[model samples]
Every structure is written in C-alpha cells, then in structure tokens.
Target: MAGLDDITNKAKEFLDSGAVKDALSSEQAEGVSDKLLDGVADAAKKVSGGKFDEQIEGARDAADKKVGNE
Candidate 1:
C-alpha cells in the first residue's frame, strides 16, 4: 500500500507541477492534462477496489482546477 500511496502522490505532484502548462499551448495542455488525469482516475478507481471513489474524484477535480481543463 505504501507503494501505491507513493505512486498516487507522485502522480498528483506531476499533475500540479505546471510543467505541462509551461511546455504546451493552452488548448493542447488542457486536452493532454485532462486525458492524463482521467486515465489516472480510472486506474486509481480500479486499484482502490472502488473504495476511494471520492478521493479519486477529488484528485481529478483538483487537477482540473489546478491545470485547467477543456
């Protein structure tokens, strides 16, 4: 579980890093970030046995708010 926690934390950090924002056009960045975050949420949901649905959702929402989404 520690490994999973680490992976989740790292994924969140990367999403919030603003690296993508710095590197891509606004439209491209939003699209790519949204896709990446959506994928992360899906995988998290599966790995969590649907137990952390709310947290997973919150993570996606945070990413959308911090990174901007289309």
Candidate 2:
C-alpha cells in the first residue's frame, strides 16, 4: 500500500511539475503509465494471494484509458 501510494505521489509530482509531458514522448508516457498500473496490479495480486485479479485488471484498464486521454 505504501509503495503504491509512493508511486502515485511520484506520478502526481511528474504531472504537477509538467515534467512527464516534457520528459516522455507520448508513447513513452503511455508505456510508463501502463507499467506503473501493471506493477500495482501485480503487487496487489501477490499480496492478496491472487484473489484480486479482477480488481487489478480493472485498474490496469483504467490506467490505460487515462494515458489515452493524456
């Protein structure tokens, strides 16, 4: 949970600083967001003993959509 929060905060900082847009190309930004979401999903699945697959999938989907929006 703490790890996830930290990642989220870092991402927010990137957005707030407007560095993500400058530092990452559109494709790279999408990839990073996807990677972050996947990491979160994997961690949650592991912590829950594979019980949160659906939740993780939804999260991944949402993250992808957000990247698309950006």
Candidate 3:
C-alpha cells in the first residue's frame, strides 16, 4: 500500500509540473498534433527506405487521432 501510495503521489506531482501543464496547454491548436506525427512518420519512412511508408502513415494517422485536440 505504501508503494502504491508513493507511486500515486509521484504521478500527481508529475501531472502538476509546469512542463506538463505547458505541454498540455500548448498542443491544443488544430493540426499541430498531426504535424508532429507527420514529422515522426517521415523519419520512420526514411529509416525504412520507404518500404514501410504506408504502414508508417497509418500509424501516424492513428497517433494524430489519439493525441490531437482538434
């Protein structure tokens, strides 16, 4: 129980941190999340030599939907 309580408190502290608050508040713009996902996907595609471009694009779209505020 103490271990669980410690973990919970640590999580609460992290959630209250200024960096977390700033990231949460700054990423609410339309298409911003998608742009980030797109950049990641492009990097993945390049790493895979375009062989996995479609798969990476699908994953990027899914990630955008999950994290996007728009």
Q: TM-score: which candidate is best?
A: 1
Better of 1 and 2 by TM-score: 1
Candidate 2: where is the Cα deviation over 4 Å?
1-25, 68-70
Better candidate by lDDT, 1 or 2: 1
| Tens digit of per-residue lDDT, candidate 3, span 25-55 | 4556336776777788889998999999888
TM-score-better candidate, 1 vs 3:
1
On lDDT, the candidate that comes out on top is 1
By TM-score: ranked, best first: 1, 3, 2
Error of 2 at 53 (Å): 0.6
Q: Would you list the C-alpha lDDT of every candidate in the order shown?
A: 0.81, 0.76, 0.77
Candidate 2 per-residue C-alpha lDDT over 7-60 given as tens digits, one digit per residue, 9 for 90 to 100: 999888878775555555377777787778878888888998988798889877
* Cα lDDT of model 1 by residue, 1-70, tens digit: 9999999999888866768556543777678878998999999999999999999999898777765444
Give each model a TM-score.
Answer: 0.61, 0.56, 0.57
Give the poorly placed runs of model 1, Cα more than 4 Å off.
1-25
